[model samples]
Target: MLFQNVIKHCRHYTAPVSAICKPSDVFTNLSNEFPYYLPKIIKTSLTKKKYEDNIEIKERIKNLSEYHTLAREPIQGKLTFLAFDALAESKDLTEEKLHQVQVLAWAVELVQSYFIIGDDMEDNSETRCGKPTWHLLPDVGLLAINDASMLRSFIYEMLKNNFDQNTSTKVENYVNEAFLTINIGQYMDIMMSKSKDFNKFTVEQYNFLNDHKSSFYTVKLPILLALELCNKVSQDSYENVNKICTDLGILLQMQNDVMDYIDRDSAPVKTSSDIQKKKCSWPAVTALQHFNEEQRREFMNCYGRWESEKVERVRELYKEINLPHLYRLEEQRINKTVLEKIKKLPDNATPSADFFYKIFDFIHQYTEDISPSILKSNVSMSAI
Candidate 1:
């Protein structure tokens, strides 16, 4: 049995001393350390197709599958966090159980990859994972849409093949439901951009959007799925896990919004696309709260033009209002609140809570992606 065989590997595994090890140290080898079961799963699904006899169709499937496999690299550790946390909490903590969780983690990553490919196409994004997006490749174009669906379909294949048939059905339902929620959130976001009304955007709506679109998939889904697989989730624990993970997700999404305005890379680039898209993001919505008549008018003037000059103008306006400082302060406040909430989770949910805190620390403490200005001082949330 795959589960029993998993013990051979776990026997060699040495638990790292906590605090001495970085989260990166835990996840740095995810792509290499974990078996690449995703490609095999994808191949199994693709091979079942009757049209494989067609040479051209076969080549396209091969190319799409290869891209899918290639994109799985540089794992972001979302799955690692859930799998290891579940393993930590398990009474058995057997190699077989850990292996099952790891496989499910791959499923989570594959689901994320599916959406990312489709999202890039929707946003007309040029690059992903430091390379051209799948849709942007020569002759791929709209065919990437089909490829994205194929990836989504492969998630079910992985679940069905790896788990008990009955349990796989539940997992499949959860995956589909999560994607539906994400699609609704995406729809709201795209509609908000199309409407282009900054005045109508509110903190409530921003939170609602992130809660559905970013939080559910990025944090809640992975933890919940892992817990389900472990047979460890309870009603109260489920509610609490969702609450904590949702908050963390919203905080992370806001960080993304703020980072958009800042110089994230060594090289300077164009201003954030949110500015160009006129998307109602956390930072932008917060800025609106503080904007005076003149500043509001100035913002309205440059909010959503495709021109680089207009984007630059919005960047300057953000500085004029000290939006960056305000954003930093808001982030500090949110981070504190999220940490406090995580700490308050019930004893039953400690594994889930610890998983969240590790992620929070990794993002807030370990990563230089966030500027020092944001983390250095305690800022009042009511400052605005």
Candidate 2:
């Protein structure tokens, strides 16, 4: 029924089909370009190292490539590259610079894949990118864990190989710092999920979680890294640009949280794993504010259970609280505030700002459209 309602509403949602760059398009271009950076696996038997099992390493990279190039959905690895694209479009970049950007873009995607594998294992997720998560595969069980590490190491290797010594050092340090930030954010997120105490979930905590966990890696780091590569960062307002990027990251993460409940395409189940796990996601946190004491008590009784009826009840409660409508309103408010900030940005920052606008527009088509009421009334039509 939830899926049906989403379908019913999505038919009315509209955005320009021409101007928008599809995630699939980005992924396709990235995939075609990714292999150029991947080293040809060594086939010789004479190799000496303490931990490097050549055969296993080859298999891992092979699997990584296969996992990334999934025919149906492939990894949406291009999310990071949007920033790179934005920077490149801001000026006419040379082929050599373009290749450097592509390598770094692939590095960002590799980081994403590395974390996704670990996150799925931690969440006990069944699927990712429309396929069984790498860890869940028949041959990959626990080996996927090591493969994730390999993926991460591959990033540094790529950086060292492709970049000048000084540039590589800075880039590596930036990525390492981002990894630390995301790990801290992940720790807080895990702790919150384990606690299951909604009292601890506040707007401040939400912003912190999203900022460190999702913002840096998803938006800010990519833009910062690409701008460094483009030599455009020093000319712009770094703090202001970072503020817009972080705010957009929170909005994107909220959209992801909402989709977990409403989109069946994410996993095999009709119900959300976040609801089942009792994670204090944006929707759950927002929906809690609308419930009366009695209703709140009743809601908690089924908040993290594994029953179909309980999940349905939770959905009904969400609808009763008009969360779908309120979510649309919040989205519009955030978008408006962000666009205003972008408009006020200094001239040097405008191109990057426009790039952000374009990326958000492309993402909103999927993230916001899945909400039934949001899609139906067309209440938040974002110009592309």
How far out, in Å, is residue 182 in model 1? 0.7
Task: Name the top lDDT candidate.
Answer: 2
Regions of model 2 farther than 4 Å from truth? 1-56, 65-82, 89-92, 235-237, 265-271, 350-356, 359-363, 371-384
Give RMSD (Å) of candidate 1 vs. truth.
9.0
Per-residue lDDT over 1-384 for candidate 1, one digit per residue giving the tens place of the 0 to 100 score:
221222223222133213523545334444355545444444544555675356665565456644643533323334445345534543746655555565667666666667777777777777543457788788878988788887676677667766787778877876887788788888988888888567679999989987887777766677677667767667775687676667666766776676667653422111236888888887679878988899889888888887878888778877788876776676666666666676566555645555555555544432223463433221101000
TM-score of each: 0.78, 0.78
For all candidates, what are the clash counts?
0, 0
TM-score (C-alpha, index-matched) for candidate 1: 0.78
lDDT of 1: 0.61
Scored by Cα lDDT, where does model 2 land?
0.63
Q: After superposition, how far is residue 328 of candidate 2 from its true place, in Å?
A: 1.0
